[model samples]
Target: MLLAMALTLWSSIFLIIKVGYCYVNLSRKKGTVASQSSTHEGAFLASRSIDGNKGQTYRECSHTALGHSIAWFQVDLGGEYSLESVKIYYRNDANWCPYRFRQFYLDVSNGSAGSTTTLTSQRKRCYKDNTTALATPPSVIDISCKETARYVIVETTYNAQEAIYLNLSGPVLEICEIEVYGCSVGRYGESCSRCHGCSTCDIISGACQCGVSFFGPNCSNACSVYCKGNLCNNVTGSCTNGCEIGYYKDKCKWTCNPGCKNGCNRNSGSCDNGCIDGKYGIECYDVCSVGCISNCERMTGTCMCKKGWQGEKCRECSPTFYGPSCEEECSPHCYNGTCYVNNGSCIDGCTRDYTGDKCTQGLYETSPEDHGTAIGAAVGASIFVVIAVVVGVVTLRLRRKRDDSSKAQKDERKESRIKYEKETTYVNRQDHSLPGKDHSLPDSHVHLGKRPANLKTQEIGLYEIMDSGNGENKTYENDVIAKTVAPVTNTSNDASEENGNVYLVINESQLNSSHYDELHVQN
Candidate 1:
């Protein structure tokens, strides 16, 4: 029971204050002790040597054969564990203790093959009695056990100096109780149940503290199932870092197919880089039928066939074309050897008695009888087109004339006047003589005052013009108008220019700059 109390106290450091739970003593029930030699009931009965009396007897401990240089006391802990630490209490804890080795060391073993070298901390001397033999090996000694093992031992050596100091006595190993702590990794609870994840769980409660690349209640499940190369969070189970290529979703549950553009979800897989184009559903998986212009959609599987092809599958002849491969072969009576694929309506039109799909149905025999009707129709259509064009042109000219008349009324006064220097010569000479005078102005051929009625049909000329002054005839550097010209009259007080309604010449150098500023308005 000394071992039980030790385990209860040790476990309290790890669980009790928070959980009020205790651990079991690994060396109590099934454990037994053995030594290098036997005494009384042998080392096996020494397993109960908690204090001094409970063991077989006083000197009946695990004593070595006399003259032997070394002795050992080993205890089987029954089951393998990630041995945390061990505490070996001395057998005789009374006033004058017996069976204290000069010095000793502890070791452990894990394998079931019973190999001896499975121990560590070789010969760790405890309470060396070199200067003077120890009164009694430490009542309690602590040993750090970083190894995994199911057996523990207390072994010692007897040297000459220590033997002589003890009056030439041989070595003997004894133990009261051996206390071991800690359970194996991944195993926890009172019965040491295994957890679900790669973690160390609460030994008493069977709770898990997961480690790298693991998840679930006991940290035994792999998180890479959906995450591919990544490890999901132990608690959240999300591949927060990222997912593998060709796999997508919150948990990377969906796989990307080649039909998807750049393998992404565009408009629920409709268009763009995120979309996978096709008929969208069942028809999308199947190949388009032969003679199809475009693939079938959904369940119809029909297509927009090519020019020569027809029907839902686009395999038969079209309305205008005939024969296999839709070669348009009209009857000889059908002009241009072309007819409608649907009813054989000739491209150049059908003959008199021939009328049907491909022109196969006809009155009498289709013997070139339809050519006369075909030629007459084509000529009639051409004649109608010519007449329509002539009518269109005449109508357009009349509309233009009406528009021009209105504009003339609005702009007849847009012209101004310039007085001639002297009697000037004019061309396209009409008499233009005034009724009140024998001659027109100073020159006979020159028309003035009242203007010529049809200036568009007449040509006239002027040598030079000048400002309102009796000055010599002077020419301007610029040739303002070279074509037909007509004499004009102006009675306005302000200086004005006389010009054809179609031509207006402005002299920027002559007009005051301010005039331009005021003139810049919307036309």
Candidate 2:
């Protein structure tokens, strides 16, 4: 019974300790509630009225309770304020709030209080934090107040809710202060607009700087201007110094002496004082006087000659004659013959009775001994005739024989004339009597007549007589036999008709018999 009473006493002590712990926790929560209630009084103002902890500030509000579990607070600053920036102190202690509030909304209005108008809105978030790091919240937020506005509202989009307490077992949210500043018109941060001829500066507010190769407030200078090494002047848009010799143009950058290794004038293309005579190429390096003949220029020797003159020096004929020495004359021979000055042969053959170089000479008499034996026999016959014949009888017989021979020769000549006429006349005679045959006679055969008595004696004798100038009379015996034949005449009318119809009629037997004795004598 005593041990049981001791145990009961211990249990009572433990129950008292538990009750004391609960009372302390309740007091702590009440204190926190009081602090929050007091801080909400001046939360409408931009600047904090109370500082609960480091970087912790309070903002005033017009209404204590704003409908629903979530609430919104708004403050109106009359007119369009050039908002330099905004600052926020976020409450982030796990022991005070459920979780850290991460996101917030900033809204702008037109008036100070009643009938406020909203101009714009923006959402923002706080940076993450560590346990030991100081809770210095972001101090600045930029806003373009292009439109006029009076009221600005800060609304909580996210809160430290129960989701963040699974591991850390408490809420984490805080705010120490909020600050706002008015910036210059049309200016924000370190950047500003150009004003009163002043150039627009950079974001850092340093002097308006230009590009590496340019200068001036607006960077209007060219790259070549103000350049030091082969540089251009800053004031002007040209090179600072002119180009050196053998160089020209802007900054002396281009080489004026191309293809000239020795060197060249930057302005002219002459060598030494002027180009040497006969040298006139790009660098005056070519020799042009060697092969020129006339009108050769001293600077650039080129030949000009008259028509039909050609050669390196115009010293030869213009292709009219072809020879190594150009001295051979053109050929001149009869009948289209071509005879070289060095050799004498006609292209075809020498002309008749012409001999010697180029066949220009006439015929000359040959000795009797030089004449053939046939010619000798002809001479011998004439001599023998003188011995055998008496003057009177021989003359009469010779005259008769001549008449017969002339008639025989006339008949032969007539036959030849008829043959020539048949060959020359180009008559297209149709032989209708003999069908399927046509005769074409030459034009020369159109006239049928006796041959001329001037028959060539050279052809008849087989040899030409050299000369016939002897005082002694020489003749050949009348070897041709003669017969006293009556002349033929057509007395009867029927006979005349028959004779007229015949084209030609000759007695061959009579002509042969009459010429037989002469043939034998000549043989």
Candidate 3:
């Protein structure tokens, strides 16, 4: 019986040991899983390349048939724990991949050495491009474990042959840091006291309190004075109805008296008693009336006129002067020692016998018309002399005409006798002349160039010429011939007629004859 009992006790103890071993192993596995899965609070985890190269070491997963470039990273939670989310900070090296880890697999396991089970799997492209550098971090992926996870593993889906030699060949992806978080267990009371009963709370303090200008556990109550009446000092508890005496609105700080027109004290709202000496009015701007004089002090007072003036305010002249003053005397040219006070002048041509100052002097009597008649007689005598001179000129002209006619007749008879004598002498001497003597004479003398006496060489009037041409002709008057023959023409032909128009002509013969006649008439 004892042996059996010992055996039973030993078996029971063995069963107990076996149970203890299993429990310990299970606890260890759970601890390992928790350590692997629990993310570090506020800590960054970096995924670096083994070769320590830059962008060439990491790459983002592709989407072609397979996926983008793949990258793997793991986190070990210290103990058995539950986590609601995980975050990875990563930067893409390629420009094509900019989204975070949108498509990824999160694997969780029990312990340090156990199979991994994917807690969550996603297929969306997380990054836009992959030009990110390795120094950059990874993005976060929240995986709900619901109080069950411990170890966590990340797997990126990549395109087939997207990476060459474990480096990104298509687009590179980089990871600079990582962060993980776990939900708090109720065993330690509320995880955050500040947000205990509030839907939102302060992230740093974690206290259950209101935000600015608010109160109450859930930030539901607002302070009263801040939103109501006139401004009230929260700290001093003071209320203001209006601004003080000299102060205006807008915090009751500005002063007012400086702009008051009637000498007001702005601060006290009181008026000063004194008015400006020369001014009076609401603002002391009106001036008092003083008359126009150097000594007048009041604006409305009358002015004192000088020695010889009289009128209202001394503005009128004296009676003697009739101007602005009464100091002037009447002029001296008035009639018979009297003076016209208004105009200061003498009366009507100063009277016949009066002259000198005020027309009081006697004058000498004389008739002015007698001198005018004497001047008229002298002018008449001058006119008679001018008429006599004109008559004398006419008589002399008539006498000259008669003398010229008689002298011309006498010269004509003498010229005719001399011409007959010269012709007979030339004819009588012709028989006694030598044969060569005829050729020896000058050309002019040979052409019957003998001088004649008794040539009638007078300028005759047209009447005389017509009377001689026609015995008793009266076609033209004597005055007409004198006027017409005043101008003479010298021409090549002594006399020519063309189309019944007579033209006086002159040649060498006419010129010589006319010249000789002019010389003889002068002698």
Model 3, 1-523: lDDT tens digits are 9999999879856964664321111221323322222222213223232212224213421111112344445545554443434444444555533343444455554433234333322221112223233322244333333233445555544332324443534322234333334432211112322246554433333333343434454555443332223432222223234444444433344444432333433334433443334433343334432222333223232455555444445455444343223455543344443344445344443656556544545566334656678788889988988897886687677757866875667656445533553464222223332232333321111111112223223233322222223367534434322211112222325334221211111222332233122111011
> Please, what are the lDDT tens digits per residue for candidate 2 over residues 298-371?
34444553343356444443432223343443234333555443344454555666665555554674544557
Look at candidate 2 and tell me the lDDT of residue 168. Answer: 29
- How large is the C-alpha RMSD of every model relative to the true structure? 29.5, 30.4, 35.5
After superposing all C-alphas onto the true structure, candidate 3 shows an RMSD in angstroms of 35.5
State which candidate, 1 or 2, has the greater lDDT: 1
Q: In angstroms, give how far residue 90 of model 2 lies from its true place.
A: 3.6
lDDT of 1: 0.49
Error of 2 at 468 (Å): 67
TM-score of each: 0.29, 0.23, 0.20
- Using lDDT as the measure, name the better of candidate 1 and candidate 3: 1
Q: What does candidate 1's lDDT look like per residue over 243-352, in tens digits?
A: 56555665665665555445444213222343243433321344444557665554555778877677776767754567655755446767666676655567776667
Off by over 4 Å in 1: 1-21, 31-44, 49-61, 93-99, 111-114, 118-137, 159-168, 188-196, 199-523
Go through the candidates in order and give each one's C-alpha lDDT: 0.49, 0.37, 0.37
User: Which predicted model would earn the best lDDT?
Assistant: 1
Which of the two, 1 or 3, has more TM-score? Answer: 1
Q: Which stretches of candidate 2 lie over 4 Å from their true place?
A: 1-70, 92-94, 97-100, 109-149, 163-176, 183-494, 497-523
